[model samples]
Target: MLYGAQYYRPPFPGRACWRRDLAHMKELGFNCVKHWAVWNWIEREPGCFDFSELDELVALSREYGLQVVINTVPEGAPYWTYEGNEEDLYRTADGQRVAYGGPANLPSGGWPGLCMDKPEFAALVAAFIEETARHFADEPAVIAIDVWNEPHLEPMYDYRSNMLCYCRHSRAAFRAWLKGKYPSLDALNRAWYRTYSSWEQVEPPPRFGTWADMLDWRRFWLDNLAGWLKLRAGAARRGAPGKVVQTHVAYSGILGNRIVGGLGNELGDEFLLAREVDWFGLSSFPKWLMGPDHAYRHLIHNEMVAEAAHGKLFYQVELQGGAGKPGLLGGEVPDAGDVKIWNWNTISAGGKGTVYWQYAPEPAGVESPGFGLTGFAGEDTPRSLAASECAGRLNLPELDAAVRVPAENAVYASRSSDLLTFASERREEMYAGSLSGVFRAAYERGIPVRFLHEDYIGELAEATVRFLYLPLPLVLSERETEHLVRFVERGGTLVSEACPGLYRPDGLLDQEGTALGRLFGLGHREIQGLPDWGMVTACCEDGTVFAGKWYRQLVNPGQDVRVLARFEDGEAAVTERLLGKGRAVWIGTYPSYYHEHGFELDGGGKRDGTRDLLTRFMSLGGYGIIEKVEVPECESSGISLAPVVRLHRLEGEYLLTVVNHLEREARVKVWFREEQAFAGGPGKCLELTVPARDGTCARWSSSRR
Candidate 1:
C-alpha cells in the first residue's frame, strides 16, 4: 500500500524546508507523497516551461525514500493562455464568460480554467500534461501522474445557474454526439420531441422543460468529461510511457449533490471515468464537508468510489488531513480516534492506498492555516500519529495478501434515475436518500452490501449476487428492465421500492405499457399523497407493521401475485410473486427513504424496536434468499457489531474487520454459512472485541489449530 500525505502544492510551505518535510514523511512511516504541478505556477509564459521547483522536490523525495505522485492542475491555467484565448473561456447558460479569479485551493489566480471542449485550449492542456509527464518520466521517485484533479464539468465552480460549457465548441460536440446516438435527424426529434430542419439547428437545451432533452444533455456532458479524461491520459502516457496515470473525482457522482452541495450538478460519470484511467480514486473530507460524526456516511462515500472503480485499483487520493477550513470557520480537527476509524474504513472498503490532503496547512490564500497533518510550526499532531500507526498496521504481510470479499447482497444504483430526479425535481435528495437508506439498513444489519450499477445489471444472472435491493427506481431503460426480469427468473431475489420504471430511460412516460408492472405482476393505480403525518403503515401476514414513507402508490396485484402486506385502509401496499425459481417483492412506498430520514432511537440512544419495512421483511421471511454472513448482535450497543463488518480472504486464510460505530465497546461473534469456506474451514465462529470509534482486524488460517 502507498501510504502518505500530499506534501506540497507550490507557494505553500515553500522550498525553505523541502528536505525537512520529506524527511518527516519518511519518519512518520509514509512511503509516498503527492505534489500538485499547478499550470499557472509552472508555465507562467506561453510555450515557456519551468521545472526547477518540481525537479528539486522530486530529488529531495528520492533522498527520503518516498515515492511521488505528481498531480497536474490544468484547471489552474496560466493567465497568458486565457488572455488571447478569450473565446475559450467557460460560458454560463446566460452566455456570460466566467471571470478569472483564484479559488481557495489555487492561491495563484486563473480560476475556472478554459473550456477543454475548444480544440485550441484542449491542445494547450495536452501540451502542459505531456510536458509535466516527460519532465519526470525518467525520475524513479515519480511513480505516477494524476492527469485531472477532481474530474467535473468546471472545477470549483459551484454556482447552479452557471452550470458549464454553453460555448459554441461544446454545442458542436453535443451535436456530433447526438448524430452518433440517433440514426437520423428525425430520430433525434422523435426522441427529444422536437422538429429540426438540420443537425446544425440542434443545441443543448438552455432551460429544462423537456425531460428527454435534459437527460440527453446531461448524458452528453458525462460522455464529454470521460472523453476529456481519455485525452489527458493519452497525453500523459505519450510523455511518461510507463508511469501509472490516475485521476479522482471530488466524490462519487453516485451520491450526486448530497456530498457536492450543488443543484443539478453535471459531474463526471465515475464508471465511465474509471475505464479511462489506470487507477480511479476520490477525495474525501468527511469532517469538513460531510458531518463530523457520521461514520456510516463516510464509509458509504468510500464504498461508492470503490464500486465505481469497477475492479480497478482505487485510492483515497485526498483524505482529510486536519481541520476543514482556512481560519475561524474551520470544522473540527480530526483527533487520533477519527484517524484510526477513517483509515480502517478505507482499508476495509478495499482501498489500495491513501494520501492525506497535505503534510502542512495552506500557508497563504483563502484556505490558509488549514488541512494539514502537521501544525503550522511543523509539529506532529494526534491525527498524524494515528495515521502513522495505521500505516504500520497496513504494512503487515497479511493485509497485503488479503483481497476484498465480494458480497452477494447488492443495492441497485441507476444513473437514469439520478438524471430523471435532477431534471424533474432540480435536486437528488429523494433518490439519493432512498438508495442510501436501504444500503444503510443492510449495513446496520451486518449484511455485506455492494452497489450494482445499471451498466452491469445484465451480469447479475451470472454473478454471485442473490439479494438485490432496488430503491426509488423512477426510471429504467429497456435493457435494465429486461435484465431485472431475467435476474429474478434465474433465482435471484429482488426487492424494489415504489415507482419502479414509471418513466422510460428517455424520460418519456410508459404508463400504459410499463415493463415494471409485468415484472412485479401488478397494475399501477393512482398515487395517494398522505397530507397528515405523511406516512403509510403496512401490515404483513405475520402482523409486522412497518412505516412506508414519501407517499403511497396504489397497485392491484395479478392473480399469480400474493399480497404480502396491506395498508391500514385495506389496500395492498406490498406484493410478492414467484418468478421461475426466485421471488420478487414490491413495496408501494419509499420505506428505505423514510428509514434514513426518520429513524427513531430509544432512551439509550440505540434504535428502538421499530424497524423499516424493508429490514422487517428481510429479518422475517427474506433472510433465506440472501447469502448470509451472520454476525451476532451486540448486547451493549443493541445493534450489530458495527455499521461495517467485512471479510477478506486469501486462499484458506481470512481477514475479518469489525468497525465499532458505537460510543462504547462492542463484542460480537461472526461466522459464515455452513456451505461457505473460511479460516478453520466453514461454520467457525470468531469472537471480536472492538473499541469505541475504532475497529479490530483479525487474521486466521485453516491450517492454524
Candidate 2:
C-alpha cells in the first residue's frame, strides 16, 4: 500500500525546507508521494523545457525513501501557450471564451479552458509528457506516470460555467464525426430531421436540443476524451517503458450535478477511458461525501470505479486531509478519528493506494488554507498524526493480503437513462438520483452493490448476482432489452423503476414493436411530467403509501403481471411480471429518490419504508441466492445503527471491516454462516460496536480458535 501525498509546486517556504517535509513523510510511514509536473510552472517559455526543480525533487524523494508518481498537469496550460494559441481555448455555444476558476476561486487566475481539439495544445502536452517520462524513465524511484490530472474541455465538476467547448475545432470535429457515422448528408438529414445543404452546415448545437444530437454529441466527447487519454497514456508508456501510467476523473459521471462541482454525465463520466493504464484512479473527499447530498453517490461511485477498473479496485489519488475551504462542515478540521475512519473505509472498499491531496498547503496560491496532511507552515497537525497512525495500521500483513469484498447485488445502471435525464430541466437533480436512491436503499440494508453498466448487462453470468436493481431506465437498445429479459429468464430477480426501455439507444421510439413491453407485460398509456406538487401518490400492495416525482407513466398490465402498487387515480403504477425462472418488480415512480431526497430523522430517510420492497424481494426466495454475511437485527437497528460492513476474503482468513456512518454511537452483531471450507466466521458469532464516525476491523479464520 502506497501511503502518499501530492506536492508539485516548487517548495513551500524555501528550497531546503522541502527535504525536511519529505523526512516528515517518511517518519509518518508514508512510502510514496505524487508530484504534479505542472506545465506552466516547468516551461516558463513555450518550447524551453526545464527540469532542474523536478529533478531535484525526485532525487530528494529518493533520499527520503519515498517512491514518486509524477502527474503531468497538462490541463493547467501555461498562460504563454494560450497566448499564442487562443484558438485552442474552449468556447461556449455563443462563441464566448470560457474563463473561470472552479466554483469558489472565480475569475481570479482562472484556467483558459483549453480543448484537445487543437494539435498545438496536444503537441505541447505530448512534448511535456515525453520529456517528463524520459527524464524519470530509468529512475527506480519513479513508480508511475500520471497521464493528465483531469482531461475534459468543460472545466472541473463544480465550475458550473456551462461553458461547453463549441469553438471552430470542436464544431468541425463534430461534423467529421457525423460524416464518419452517417455516410451521406442526405442520410444524416433523414435521421436528424434537418435538411442541411451540406455536411459543413451541420454544426454542433449550442446546447442539447434534441435527443438525437444530444446523445451523439455526448458520445462524441466521450470518444474524444477516450482518444486523448489513449494518446496521453501511450505517451507516458513510451517515456517510461515499464512503469504504470494513470489519469483520474474528479467525480463519477453518475453523480451528475447533485453536488456543487459534478460535471454532468454527458461530458467525461466514462470509466473505461483508456485501458492501457495499470490502474484507474479517482478523487474522494471524506467530508464532502459525509452528507445527505453526496453520501449515497459516493458509496455508489466506489462500486462503479471498482467495476470500471476491470472488476477490481482503484487508487484514491486525492483523499481529503484537512479542513476544507468552507472549513469542512463549519470549519471543523478532521480529527485523528475522522482521518482514520475515512482512510480505513476507503481501503476496505477496494482502494489500492491512498494518497492525501498534498504534503503541505501552498503558501502562495488560490487554494490557501488548502487540504494538506501537514499545515502550510510545515507544523504537524492532528491530521498528520492520524495519517501516521493509519499508515502504520495499513502496513499490517493482514490488510495487505485481504481480497476484495464480494458484491452480492448488481445495480443495473443505464447510461442511456443518464442521457435521458440530461435532457430534462431537472437533469441536475435527477442525474443518477434514482440510481443512487436504489443503491442507498440497498446500502442501508447492508447489501453490497456492484454498478454494472447497462452495456454489460448481458455478461453477468460469471458472478452470482441475485438482485438486479434497475432504476429509471428510459432508453434501451434492442440488444439491451433482450439482455435484461435473458438475465431475468436465468433466475435473477429484477427491481425496476417507472419507465423501463421506452425508446431505443438512438433515442428513437421503438415504433415497430414493443420488445420491452412484451417482456415485462407493461403497456404504456400516457405520461404526466409536472403540475406543481401534483406528485403521484402510490399505495403498495402491503397498504403502504408513498409519494414520488418524475413523469408518471400509466401502464396497463398483462395477464401474467400482478399489480403490486397503484397510483392515487387507481391506475396500476407498480407491477410484477413473472417470466420463466425469474421475476421483475416494476415500481411506478421514483419512490427511492423521494426517500433519499426527503430524508428526516423520524422518517429515518426510509422513504415510507421503501426498504420493505427490498425485504419483500428477499422473502420471495431471494435471500439465499448469493453468499453474504448475515448481520442479525441490522434491519431493526437501521442504517444509523448498523455500521457499514465489508468483508474481504484472504488466503486463510476473512478480513471483515465495519464503519459507523452516523455521528452517534451504534452497535451491531455479525454471524457468518459456515461454509464447508471456510467454517463460520470469527469461529463463532460475535457482537461488537464502534465509536461515532469511526471504523473497526477483525481478522478471523477457521483455525483461529
Best by lDDT: 1
Sequence-dependent TM-score of model 1 = 0.94
Summarize candidate 2's per-residue lDDT along 543-588 as a digit string, tens digits.
8766666668777788889987877779887788888788878777
| Inter-residue clash pairs, candidate 2 | 157-261, 158-261
Per-candidate RMSD vs. true structure?
Answer: 3.1, 3.7
lDDT of 1 by residue, 421-534 (tens): 878746577777778777777766676677888888877977567778888888877788788888888887888887789898889888864665768888888777877636
* Cα lDDT, model 2, residue 229: 83
Worst 10 residues of 1 by lDDT: 601-610
Model 2: residue 54 alpha-carbon error in angstroms = 1.3
Off by over 4 Å in 1: 256-264, 326-329, 599-612, 616-641, 675-683, 702-705
